[model samples]
Target: MSLLENILYFQGGLGVLANMFLIIFYTCIILDHRYKPMDLIFCQLTFIHIMMFLTAGEIWLADIFESLNVKNDFKCKATFYIYRVMRGLSICITCLLSVFQAVTISPSTALLAKYKHKLKQHIIKASLYIWSFNLSFSSNLIFYVGGFTNVSETNQMKVFKSCSLFPINYIIRGFLLTVTTSRDVFLVGVMLTTSTYMVIVLFRHQRQCKHLHSISQLRTSPEKRATQTILMLVVFFVAIYWVDFIISCMSFLLWMYNPVILTVQKFVMNIYPTITPLVQISSDNRIINVLKILWSKRHQIFKKRWFFCLL
Candidate 1:
């Protein structure tokens, strides 16, 4: 294998491992109600991340090993369709998580607070809807995506391996692209607006606490910490997502002239999903405590071994 391909595979393998860790962590959170609504959403988000990573990993493998390639048009279409569906669902779920937290931490008298009572139930229903809608919408992809086949002048047939959207009627293609762009734009808009709202709410609350000389009271609250974590998640997600989007556009415009641009786009695209679990753990006291206990046990074992060696 080429060095670059090996590096790509290594990076993808790391992403798969990190996503697995997150899946386990989220599963622990979901099995216990102390974590509640947010944990449920986190679990779902982790699952989506795993799917995205696995699907992308498979594509990379197919690129490397001809035996693993998509052998037929149906497989190509299905692979592309599944990846797009998962990607769309990921965006929608993240947006939902952000908005849910924003509403959860809103002031009791605020209009958004009215829905907070049943937000847990709403989260379940929203998750189901997001999955169903994304799957249905992405089904449109099957009509235009497939493995390309070319026949050479020497009378040999070559089947291109990658899953790609084949060009269709211009109007139909444009419509599909428009629908996709609209969905992304809408979800991103909601995420930004809700995250910004939470920041404003947090700032105002901090100001009020300052006026009352109770800033410490506000700072110590779980809600305040969650607000900060979600805001940070949003910042990381937006930064990586838009950069990937721009790179994707550039790659398309350049049309195979620069392979490096597409590679960079893929790298950026995976950044958010790969690192999100670490972001979550950083702000989660429960997860941190568990990690500390595990670390202490490992450290104690190492110390005992060293003492025995000294004796």
Candidate 2:
């Protein structure tokens, strides 16, 4: 394989490993505590990350090994459809997560705070609704997507280059595209707005307590830490998505000839999923405390064993 292809594989491998870690981390969290609604939703998000990486990774591998035969039209369409749905779901869940956190940290008398007690009760229902909506929305992609055929002398597949979109007339295609784009735009707006609200809440809380503490004495509140984590996730997600959006628009206008755009887009999408769990571990005190406790216990055991052996 070429250097670029080799790099893609390496990145893809790292992304898979990251997703695996996210899965394991969240699964342990749920196992330790009674499976909370947020935990379940987070687990769903991680699962989507795994599937998203797998779907994209498959296309990447297909590009790498030109020798592998392309699947039938159904598989091609289904794969892309599933990928799109998972992607949409990711956005929805992120937005949901932001809103959940925002609600959790809202002032007692605030309108959002009213739902604080009720949100968790409906999280499962809300999540199911999100899945259903995205699934229905993305079902259109299957009809538009076609199989990869007409391989060139260089053994490059058309699907690897660019999968066909809405084979209908321009007007119909435009309408479908607009619907999907608007959906994304709306969800992103929700994520940004909620995240910003969270940051503001943290700022206000910090400001109110500013007089009581010196600069060195100030510590990060769990709410503030969680807000920062969510904000980072949202910022990373929006940046990657908008970059992908621009690249996709450019590629479409340019006849999608650029392999580099696709590679970069895949890489950008992987960044959030790969880094999110690490960020979570950093922001979450419980996880860090557990790790520290385990490490200290192991060290003590090792010290005892060493002393016994020396004696």
Best by lDDT: 1
Q: Please, what is the TM-score per model?
A: 0.84, 0.82
For model 2 the local lDDT of residue 303 reads: 91
Residue 175, candidate 1: C-alpha displacement in angstroms: 1.2
Stretches of candidate 2 above 4 Å error?
35-37, 59-71, 151-168, 214-218, 253-255, 290-311
Give the deviation of candidate 2 from the true structure as CA RMSD.
5.3
lDDT of 1 by residue, 213-278 (tens): 999999799889987888888878878887876765443333232345545556677788877887
* Residue-level lDDT for 46 in candidate 1: 80
Candidate 2 lDDT over residue span 1-311, tens digit each: 66766877777677677667667878987888755556677788889988887777666534533456555565567668778888888889988888898888899978888887777677878898999998898887576567655434333224344454433555765676678679889988988888788878877777777866643333556566666777888888888888877766555433344456667777777777777767776776766886788787997889999999999
lDDT of 1: 0.75
Q: Which ten residues in a row have the lowest lDDT in candidate 2?
A: 151-160
